[model samples]
Target: MVEKRATQRHRVFKGGTITFENSGIACTVRNMSEGGAAIDLDTTITLPQSFTLLIERDNFVRSCRTVWRSDRRIGLAFVQ
Candidate 1:
């Protein structure tokens, strides 16, 4: 298979939250890179066009946009 990512992604299993306005949902990070990440969300609630991805344990928060989705998982690209 051909690799299409601009950067390598490392597998991860950390708890995080997806927040938009005053709402938040829990999710788990599946894999991550400098550019983006794959996260497993508990629910398929409609998220905003752009929202904050917070991994407090890692002290990480970035503005992100959804790239794709399948079932309860979604791919996110960090906005610089």
Candidate 2:
């Protein structure tokens, strides 16, 4: 398979939150890079087109858009 990502992601296990419209859902950061991240949710649910991703341990917060999704996992692209 061809590597299509703009930046390389590092495997990680970090707590994250997907926040939108005054609501937040818990997620697990499975892999991350400067450009984007892959996250896993507890259950399959519909998320907004765009949302904020927060990783408290790293003091990270960024606006993200859904790039792809399958089951409980989601691919996100950081929005500038």
Candidate 3:
């Protein structure tokens, strides 16, 4: 298999929240890198074109955009 991402990702299992405006949903951080992350949710959802991802334990917050999605997972690219 070929790796297509610009940066390597590391596997993770951390709680996360996807928030836009006043709404938010819980997610699990599956894997992450300096450029992006892959998150898993409880169910399929419709998210905004862009939103903020908060990983409280890591004190990490970043603006991101959806890059791809599956049944209950989403790929996100950090906006800089």
Candidate 4:
């Protein structure tokens, strides 16, 4: 399949936590790009059509929005 993303992805997997409106959960970032990310969650978590993702990396913190979701994963994109 052809990929149609403008940003290049980093293969580094990072450990992180996800706080949803309904619940707070621990998740792992599968990969990341300048534009978005794919997250792996322990269990199925229903994500709103749009939500905020607070990502903390050492001294840096970033926020993104949920664009898509599945049974055990979610896709987030950077908010302009």
The regions of model 4 sitting more than 4 angstroms off are: 55-57
Over 4 Å off, model 1: none
Q: What lDDT does each candidate get?
A: 0.94, 0.96, 0.96, 0.72
Give the CA lDDT, 0 to 100, for residue 46 in model 3.
Answer: 88
TM-score quality measure for candidate 2: 0.96
**lDDT tens per residue, model 1, 1-80:** 99888999999999999999998899999999999999998878888899999999989999999999999999999999
Output the worst ten-in-a-row residue range by lDDT, candidate 1: 40-49
| Superior by TM-score: candidate 1 or candidate 3 | 3
Residue 59 shift from truth in candidate 1, angstroms: 0.7
Q: Rank by TM-score, descending?
A: 2, 3, 1, 4
Against the true structure, candidate 1 has what lDDT? 0.94
In Å, residue 39's CA in model 3 sits off its true spot by 0.2
Runs of candidate 3 with Cα error greater than 4 angstroms are none
How far does residue 15 in candidate 4 sit from its true spot (Å)?
1.1
lDDT of 4 by residue, 1-80 (tens): 89877887787577777665766567788878889888888988666555555557744335667767787878778666
**Over the stretch 1-80, how does candidate 3's per-residue lDDT look in tens digits?**
99899999999999999999898999999999999999999988889999999999999999999999988999999999
